[model samples]
Target: MISKNTIDQVFETARVEEVLGDFVQLKKSGSNYKGLSPFTDERSPSFMVSPVKQIWKDFSSGKGGNVVAFLMEHEHFTYPEAIKYLAKKYNIEIEETEQSSEQKQQEDERESMYLVSEFASKYFQNTLLKTEQGKAIGLSYFRERGFTDETIKKFQLGYCLDEWDAFTSEALRKGYKLEFLEKTGLSIVKGEKQFDRFKGRVMFPIHSMSGRVLGFGGRILTNDKKAAKYLNSPESEIYHKSKVLYGIFYAKQAIAKEDNCYLVEGYTDVIQMHQSGIENVVSSSGTALTSEQIRLISRLTKNITVLFDGDAAGMRASIRGIDLILEQGMNVKVCVFPDGEDPDSFARKNSQADLQEYLLENAKDFIEFKASLLFEDAKNDPVKRANLIQDMVSSISKIPNQIQQEVYIQECSRIMDISENVLFSTLSQILAREGKTSGVQPKKAPAMEVVRSPEAVKTKVDELFELERKIISLLMLYGTAEEEFEDMVLKENDKGELVMEPEIQKAKVFEKIFLDLQEDEVAFTNERFRELYSRIISLLNEEGEVNIEKFINGLDPELSSEVTTLLMEEEQYRLHEWERMNIMVKTKETTIARLVGETILALRRFLISQKIDDLSRKIKESSEEDTKESMEDIMDYLSLKKVLSNKLNRVM
Candidate 1:
């Protein structure tokens, strides 16, 4: 086990937004950072990381915590592993006795593999930037491709030497396990011998969204006829070729910001476009684009523009990705470069403005682009033209949205010079055929339960439960905030009669809540709330304020999860930012004092009502002797009720 001192230091030093930004593309939102949830498929951003609070909340998936929790949940790090990862990241020295075995690959195979891949990426990069062989080969290749020194460093581009075992031997000397070396496919192991997988090639490290190196795509600098020009890391535990995009780690923010994604076919294409200031772009990693790959972009934007080579073979090879994009209901546009040109060449030859203009001008809807490509030689031939029309409709039919399908059908009709009805009939035929083969009918939505007011259906226990929840939320959110509270005091006036009056007093939120609840002798009804209530109170009293981060870190997973959930409930409403639209919306932060007082007033009123009801029932069940005492109790309770209503009026 790691020392508590180390864990505490990690938590205090690790910035939530900074740490999460590596894995999730985060943009500033007022005081917090917001991004799309990496856990689920979504178009809008629902994940929030608060740097001040030092916690994260993914409202979409409802999984959140401090920095370590994010690593544990996303990276699948064990508790000790998470701490060590942080320690390494922050350059904190872990006590040797606790972390002696941490370097072994056998302890956690997946994480060890990740560490090795990361180390390999750095090794290759060092060789490229520092070594004579790598500088002559890899640096020359990137520079010739119009990549600047800054661009090279930003992408962490590197090169591995041609000599076999160079990378493997260095990794072994550094104490990286050979098992992870082979598992990540960075090295080719044969019994007692090991060789570098990417030797003699310019390296393009394929990164996970969080910026961990999953694998590499190395381009051969020499024209060796016996070797594949482009070699990719073999499918490994961390790197799945079909699921990774070359520049996604860098392009994610721009994609979300521009609300458009430009999909390319290779690493150089992505790097060149990004160098040309086209930041909202990524590569399919030189493979046929998959739905999984498309879904990754869909999380950022529902609009994709695929840049294909101008050659007929290149166009034909990439034609199917459009259908897959359409199937995901994304608005896809195809931009084929001029003859003898691709994104890499065009980006190199033209200025940024010219490239941007060319892309904007050439981009066509899927139907128009498909028609132009498929009808290249078939336009004058009636039989082939009709077949090509069928192909066009087939792609359109893949669109899941009926409205988008109809729009594309209209375009197909216009471009193919066919009747709209004819295209619609053909699309219907394709969809109907697919539906029949699909064989899964959509299930109807389950009936929604009718909601009634609490007055009509709630028991006293339920009401108390809700009130208790509010108390917890208030304490958790604003316990240390100082505010002026109106304490309603019942006292004897000059007329010697007991009368209720308001006493204005300033108090910390926790003190106000603590005194009121203690005054009323109110106990929490729910077990979790009861525990949290006492714990929060104790922390406030003992520490003079709640250390939310420390308190949450000390909690068990269940309670910590509960605290995160409660804290993030308001984030859903905050995302709307209705005040920007002049809606005059009030935030809880502005009215916390009133909020605390009202919650307590409501709790007091409910308890008083319950007491009056209990007394009335007893009066009915008992004799005249009991009725006298019950009537006086009811009168006093009514007076108390009147005082509560007045207090509520002031608080409201």
Candidate 2:
């Protein structure tokens, strides 16, 4: 267990902006920063980060919290894992209490797999440096590729011996489980025999965005034509190639700093680009680009430049990814290297500046690039050219922003030598097709047909609204108070006058609400509202101040999001900003304690009045001997009404 003091230190030292900026691109807006919501698929910027409050709120999804909360929400990290990540990032020393074997055994299986993968990475890397076979084969292969020793070490390059079961034996001797080895795809098992999966190949460890080793990618060296060029770890608990981008661990900072990412297609391409001084480069690892991977890059930067080989097939295959990027509201540009050249070969042939200039001059927006590349064959054919125009409009319609989509349509029409109205009509058809395909519609609830006195229902709703308003006011004002109300007695002096001693007291509305709900046995109908009310009361008791900021900061992301949505919603009666600035807003001169007491009394009176009205209407409508029962109910209602009326009169 981490000490409470250490947790406090971690929270205090970690800055919200600095931590979140690593993942989400933020731009200054007023006293806060705004970016596209990472929690949802949205085009416009709705996620907000406040430096003054040290918190973030996703206006779209409603997730808000401190830095640790952001990590937990965005990265799916647990509390302890988030803390450790922050501790590592901030270079803080962590002191932990020793855990018993049983407690250690209770750790999550995924986390355990991650730990085992990390251990295997270190073992393979150590073998490369310490063992003769690893040094001769792995080190030699890397050196032959012109990889400096520093680069080799930086990427943790390693090798596995050709001898069967060498890595398996070493891991077992070190007490690592063979089951986990197979689970992480590090060891292949046939019947009862287990052997290292990457034996006789050079190692390339694949990492999660946070730099944890999730799996590995190995390249074979022998000239056997039957042997595959590269083999990556199969899907495991921690590694999903579709959702993971290679080199994100190394490229994140550079991506953030440059505000752009250069995406290529191989591990060596990534290594060579970084080696040649372009640090913000990542690879797709030869898989089809996925929206998840695009989102991963989108979180760090809004601009992406895809570098592909000049082969026609390769360019065609990669054009599909551009539509995905456009759908994300990312600004995408494409640069095709010369024939027979990839990013690795191109970077190696030129200096960083020359290569950067070459890319900058050659890169074109998706629309222009797509048209120029595809229009050559369709120039003389009207039907094929019309089909090409439709295809471009379909891609344009995927862009969420109306303005961006319109701009692309105009560009498409101009480039294709077609009428703008023709492209616009195509876009409308595409949208209609998408709407039908998605079946997007607002859900309607079946109406309840309860017969009741309209006045009674209205009165009940009004009373409930008043009670809620009072509770909201009190919570906003004195939720942090620590004491109960003080009592006072009044005595008649002479004639019909009464004199009372004034008592200034602190009120505990939170406690009162809890106890009152328990006493009246009234159940809240809305589960979220009930949970939020209960949590607010608990938080008030835990901290002297309810600190709206801190309370929201510590809540679970889903709940926090709901609470933020509630608090930030505009009420029907709101003071205008100008009125507030001019101090024209009404002020209750009476103490907040008294206001709370009066508010509760008013709610009780209101509810009693509603009951009286209901009974009166029933008496007017009913015609039975049960009229006697109705009469009794009316009497009871009047009696309570009289008592409430007296209380209300006395308070006024």
Candidate 3:
């Protein structure tokens, strides 16, 4: 476990804007930075990062958090991973407290595999630069591929020696267990023998979005006909090939900045493009495209331009990935290289400006590319032409956005010399048949009307959530600020009966919140909210002043994310911006008394209204013998609700 001092040091040293800017393109908007959400696809920016508050909120996805939470959410990293990442980024030396032997044994297996993979990557790279055979084979192969020394080191290109047990023996000698080596697919073991998996192959280390080495892809340098040309790490707890794109870690920022991604086929394709000054590129790593991969790109941008080789296989590649991109509501454009040249050779052969210009001029929409490619074989045969039309329609049907589909349909009609109505009719038939076979009803064509839910009915339960959120937000922002609180106290009068009297006292914001909620006997309906409420009260009791940073660090990442959202949701203007604009927005500090009373009263009213409704329902459903008592309770509840509503000046 990371020590508290180290976590605090990391938080104090790490700048949220600088850290997130590496992943998303942020432009200045008012006092905050705004950008398209990295969590969801949005053309207009709704993601806001507040430097003052040290938090980010993505209005599109309802995800908001501090720096650590953002890393956890965006990269799917564990708590330790996020901390370690921030520590490394900010140059903070992480200090870990010693754990017991049993606690040490409980460390995650995935982390163990990661450690082993990282060690092996360093070992391989060292071998390539320092060893004779590795220098002679792996370094020579990479140099022949036109990879410069800087590019080679940037990609962490390496080599695994040809000997069967060379890496395995070295790893074991270093006290790294064979169990982890085999698990990371750096070494393979059988009964009494062990061998390296990528013997004599130049290595390409594949990284996760946060730059951890998840796996490796190695290309065999030997001319042995029996040997496989390329080898990849087997799927393990840390690596899933389908979900990872090769150069995403390096290209994420460029992709967001360009608002488009250039898709290519191999690791070299991505490396070459990056080298040639087109940094916004990622590769499928020579694997068939999957929706998971498409979704990954969608987070950064909604436009994907596939760069295809001029060969026949490239045509098939473009066709296979086009529908998938369209299904995700992303625009797909294809740029074909000149005859017989691939992205690798083409990028190397042309100047950066020339290559970029060629891409811009030659790129065609998927419909145009598809139509032109298929027309070659289908032109003279009516049957083949019909099949080609159906093929185009089938791809068009996969599109979820109606407007995009219509645009593509018109483009297809023009290219194929078919009428729009004919294409639409075929598309309609295909959608109907597929819907029926898939046990779904096809949406009614073009004439669909929007339906709105009824507005006449209102739920008190719904209003309570807003009130609950407001109360929590205030507590998080101003919980330690001092306040004078007034409350009604029950006391005995001159007579035997008890009467209510006013009591005034000075207390902290947290005290007022706890006492107000306690007096009302209200409980939070949301589990996370209730958890935060309890934690705040406990911390206040244990410590005098509530340190927001420490409190945030103590909560789980998910709960901390929620707390951040509540804290940042309503803050649109910073103090400096407001002053500059000559706009005086009321803050809790100046209006603490009124704000506190109103929030408490609002929550009381919501809870009372809910109770009154429940009693009313119970009275109607109760047996005759119990109806009178239930009705009496309902009347009392309604009377209290009316009083609370009047105090809040809310309509009953």
Q: What order do you get sorting by TM-score, best first?
A: 3, 1, 2
Q: Is candidate 1 or candidate 3 better by TM-score?
A: 3
Give per-model CA RMSD. 9.5, 11.4, 7.7
RMSD of 1: 9.5
- Give the poorly placed runs of model 2, Cα more than 4 Å off: 1-80, 86-107, 436-652
Candidates' C-alpha lDDT: 0.84, 0.76, 0.83
RMSD of 2: 11.4
Determine the C-alpha RMSD for candidate 3 after optimal superposition of all C-alphas.
7.7
Across 191-274, the per-residue lDDT of candidate 2 in tens digits comes to: 989988888889899988777999889899998788788999999878899999889888876786577999999998999899
Residue 67 displacement (Å), model 1: 5.5
Clashes of each: 1, 1, 0
**Taking the tens digit of each residue's C-alpha lDDT, what string does model 1 give over 1-652?**
5667777788888777877888899988888888888777788889888877778888977888888888776755557778888888889877533444645444468779889988988999999999999898889988988789999999999999999889999999999988889988988988878888888999999987656888999888787999999999999878898998999879876786677999988999999999999998999887889989988887778999999887988788778888888888899898989899999999999999999999899999887887778787897899999999999888877877777777777777788888877777777677788872222222346699988987898545577878888999999998999999877678878987667688899999999999888877888878888899899999888987778788888887668878887787777766766677877766799989788978988898889999999999999898998899899999989887877787677331
Question: Model 2, residue 402: displacement in angstroms?
Answer: 2.1
Top TM-score prediction, candidate number: 3
Over 398-498, each residue of candidate 3 has an lDDT whose tens digit, in order, gives 88877777777888888899888788878888888878222222334587688767895565566777777777788878888887776645456788544
As for candidate 1, its clashing pairs are: 23-210
Ranking by lDDT, best first? 1, 3, 2
Cα lDDT for residue 576, candidate 3 = 33
